[model samples]
Target: MKDMFCFQCEQTAKGTGCEVKGVCGKTAPTAGLQDKLVGATIGLARAVQKTKATEATDVCIKKALFTTVTNVNFDNESLTKMIACVEKKKAELDPSAENYDMAKLWEDNEDIRSLKTLILLGIKGVAAYAHHAEVLGFRDPVVDAFFYKALVAIGSADAGMNDLLPLVLETGTVNLACMGLLDKANTETYGTPVPTEVPLTIEKGPFIIITGHDLRDLHLLLEQTKGKGINIYTHGEMLPAHAYPGLKKYPQLKGNFGTAWQNQQKEFADVPAPILYTTNCIMPVKDSYADRVFTTDVVQYPSMVHIGDEKDFTPVIEKALALGGYKEDKEMTGINGGKKLLTGFGHGTVLGVADKVIEAVKAGDIKHFFLVAGCDGAKPGRNYYTEFVEKTPKDTIVLTLACGKFRFNDLDLGTIGGLPRLMDMGQCNDAYSAIQVAVALADAFKCGVNELPLSMVLSWYEQKAVCILLTLLSLGIKNILLGPSLPAFISPNVLNVLVENYNIGPISTPEADMAKLLS
Candidate 1:
């Protein structure tokens, strides 16, 4: 990178390149290390193509991509170590293996760079789902194989729009498979999620705050701390844990502690309990709570106690006990002042009652459906999501996923044909569920998905959201409204291609966007 050009996420500075540092709190050194890691990962993928992808290769690419995701790995030391590992693996596989310098991708013609960015970032999102599923012993060799192909395409010479465009859409196809694999792993392992309300109150006593989207880590922590007097409060994407029967059955899996991930700096500054980070969206840990920050898997911070592959959380448990949390029950409210929020309206739950939802639409009880889902950020225009949901017509049903739902999740938009107006569709990974429901609705209505009364008004923040957007576009889902702002990586021409082919564009005022989308 000339000066560390990164515009992978929604919060890119002024919707342009972040030449100095990332708005998400990443340093130049960290970005360079991530670039090197991606380069090494591409080399490894090339070598794997020559040989064959193993379970280990799948694991390596998954970790490499996950590590490069924004806010996941800020510690340059860890990223450098990851690069070394990828290089070593490449050498073992192909003695002639050479790392692809990221400068080539960064300095490429603008349109090529944009398309390649779409593939790389989209795979990063897929790798996240793959890694999570692998943790639970669900591996799709077909999905795993696509990573190598996509990486090779990204690194290949003479590759341009004609070569890379199909791979770009394939990334979405593979990501859908990855998400389906994860959905199976999650549902089979944790039981399909049900509608459940979680309190925002922090129970009195020693506790552990588990952030990120990994339920396996949360389950392990609950197991280790079962009788240890430490209550486990879900934070960030982990908030949906309360709806899973297996997770909620754990008596110690208490209520949620904080709101979305972006508020962690202030919300966790003086948190009395130890905080365990199992995935990304971690802000630079404030010194006030640094000692209590424990990271695992791909999430790493320098000097934080890292719980490695063994998944032994005893260190975190001991810290929680040592810190001895709040003196009394601390009641917290969401931004809306509502005491509780509901989640677990995934495909299973929604499709289980699809008949009623369809009947309601036919009877005009539900006129339109909006899938307002994506990552939440702390930028100026983020409130567009909340306002969009609030202003949706009374007869419209709003389905949400990811941390962005925190904006207005507590509003209790009432019910339509016995279904809540707003249905929380688990985490961003659960975009798989939204896709399933969309395809099903299109089938039922005997029309294309775009022809259905459903619209996707998405708010994106990171690479995962980037991949999800690509997946939607790849599926030919059109006329989608994207906001906060359009991605910075998309040059004017590339965006024109998308606008002409897909009709995707940034959101305007909530009222205007709603009117346009509903029209």
Candidate 2:
């Protein structure tokens, strides 16, 4: 019998399912526990459909799904406890509802399996965004309701391609709403992001590096660490925290530490400070630095100190002071050898200058706009993103988000019509910002978004990228160039549907693709 079956991420073994161990370093047992957790979540959703869903049920559902996302939780004990919690909640809702068998979906027909996997994984991404917004005291009923609907659909024995295909698109549609909700929650709570330069240098003295997508955790850590003489540095998806007025106000929130999520093992090997993870993209804990690792929210690793629901950061703070950081100031550079990174060109900042952008485009100062964004991975061929940005025409603008920008974010692309040619939007969820800007620009040009001189070259690694791509497709956007590889779960028949309907194709060489896009 297979020890584990998983193909949810782009880097699945041999471009197929992982039958023994996960490429992300998850063991067979850990993968099995995650499957059980997902099964239990499906049961909870089934129960909620029969009875009514309370806020507690909603919170449990989101947390349960988020827990199964890639690299979020690796502790078998935590997974077992989460399964129990989900089962307990399911019983409270309706004792008759039973957990769905994941094997049924996994062993189903190829097209049906492909459609179901898209809906299931896509909502995992939505659940992450919903959890982020929920922690900030924001909730959308539509986004919440769809979680139950999607889980129910996945578990339905009668569900076919026709039924699952629309849900696949609906997953994207709801994710768009969820992303917008998160944008509102973030902007309203932390204030709209402003364009600011973030350094790649690490200062001397005690410090803590916080990674992942949770801003409230960062805000609370910034609050607890105030006047403590310890510095805080953003890592991975948390790098954009330096641009928020609410976060940047903390004088001790130092510059970023490393590049993207995939580089953490090498980048963090010798750091003298504790690293706190607040969300996904955590690799296996290495013995070299396991003692200094801390996690909170949905991120967990065995034996790592986790700041629980109380939001207490004392352990992390104490660990920082214990390490004492570098003896002298440490300078760092990005992948391109640039010493600084610029972020905070979110939708708010971009739309603030819409008139200027519109005028520039009308005068032919801006030829085309390329949104080269999405998650980065450890796989080869990712250099395509770097070379693509470097080869773009001077009159074209490049907008990037998520860790993928690390490939070329530090390059000095200069400017076009008083604006930097390459603009950094926020994190993965900030795909909402990219979509909003596209629609606004389309409105101003009196053309459809696809008709505008824009091309989307996206690189996806995990479920979050799945939902974002679905969102783009549901919006009727076409000709998006996706790479370094297509998803393993997508059946050839389904891929043909996407190519016929949306014209989506895997990326070729940067030179050839750029020429094709321009042509």
Candidate 3:
């Protein structure tokens, strides 16, 4: 009957959290449902540990975990079915191991609840990454095992920081592995990305606008739309597709459509094409343009036509044909009035130039590298990212990924040592690319990743971002600046542990934070 949330960031204030319930606007029943869903996912992870990994088992774990990510799946019916599937998996794995009551974790003491919440929510984030990697034909034993271990700890009263702290970092460490696996899957499947310019223009003629974070779905849509006289445009995280040989080779796969995820509500209104969402950061639908919205894979919306396994995509195509896009070629500009945006500075691209990067750093030509990356949200203060990137000295290189880069990605940051000052490293999943680049740079310098002159200033609005942050922490990369606001779910105790162990902090003004970071 009530909502409950622990506001954990600057975006939320007296009105952000449900005073009596939650600042996140989460209802008690929905909160209860989420708890049950997470518990079942833990059970599923435990089941997979007992049994050999199979397509079904992996799908169950991935979909279950990803479904619970913030703003992904909001339907109770879908969640309940997933929970049932997990329970069935548990029964098949160990008939005697009792299913742990998950509600207990939510009902634990405040301090214990806080710490456990960090581990559990953090793992949920990790699970999303692991799931993405698993889909791409990559899997790691270390990453898989931690899911079971962490899930088991959630229900254990005997667990402590001695146990949870390791688990927290383990989530990060495994996430790194998972990210590596995904990097392999992506680069291997789609040839390594190269620096390519992408337009924000919605070109004239029949076209479909694909959004969210799934490359697989985008690939499928590209296949279906080809030879149909229709064009495909990337939106949000999909911008990096311009770098991949697999997707970019499709000639019909046109340029980008909108800026970032948060701008879709305003950007997509009255659009002359159908939009497909394959992942998160989807906003509540507005009536003016709801007819053009379609979702596939893990992304779902009530009353929307969900493209199932059949993946026919007939409806989306039909909508595209009907809309017929622009009357003539429509040229658009990015947030900064730039006619084009660039992407595909993935790990391969970054590492291929490792010699140049190292040399630049050594010669003091490039003094610092900033990973100004993460999810973009509607938070008013998020413009700090754009400002941060704008103010970064010309001598510094900025690496960015996911939808956040749309904030400043359009700016022609010029070049340093034959490379652009700003490099677009694909989607959030491609944070794997960023990690790979960092490791290679470290190796070139003959040092650890932390020893490299790189600072990660991340902005998170959802769970996938959470897992990536944990992976960074797990790798022992210190002094991360996270913004535009912290999750409402992380408690003070958990935050304290993160601050003490990893030195993570919130973002300040671009000038102030950049000065602090560069100094």
Of the candidates shown, which would achieve the greatest lDDT relative to the real structure?
2
Q: How do all models score by TM-score? A: 0.98, 0.99, 0.92
Of 2 and 3, the candidate ranking higher by TM-score = 2
Model 1: residues with Cα > 4 Å off, grouped in runs = none
Candidate 1: residue pairs that collide? none
lDDT (tens digit, per residue) of candidate 2 on 1-519: 899899999889999989999999999999999888888888999999999899999999999999999989999998999999999999988999999888888999999999999999999999999999999999999999999999999999899888999999999999999999999999899989999999988999999999999999999999999999999999989988888898899999889999999999999997999999999979998877888999998988988888899999898888889889999999999999999999999999999999999999999999999999999999999999999999999999999999999999999999987899999998999999999999999999999999999999999999999999999999999999999999999999999999999999999999999999999
Q: How accurate is candidate 3 locally (lDDT)?
A: 0.78
Q: What Cα-based lDDT does every candidate model obtain? A: 0.89, 0.94, 0.78
* Candidate 2 CA-lDDT value: 0.94
* lDDT string, candidate 3, 1-519, tens digits: 334443332344452444353223344565556668777766666566666656666667667777776667655666677778888877887665556666576567766776676677676677776766666677786676666777778877798767776777777777777777777777788888888988766667999989877777888888888899899998887788788888889999879887887688899999889989887656777887899999887777767778987788999999999999898888888888888988888877778878888888889999999999988877688889988888999889999998888888889889987899988888888888888788888887889987788999999876678778887887788899988876666668778877998789988888889889877
Please identify model 2 stretches exceeding 4 Å from their true place.
Answer: none
Considering every candidate listed, which one attains the maximal TM-score? 2
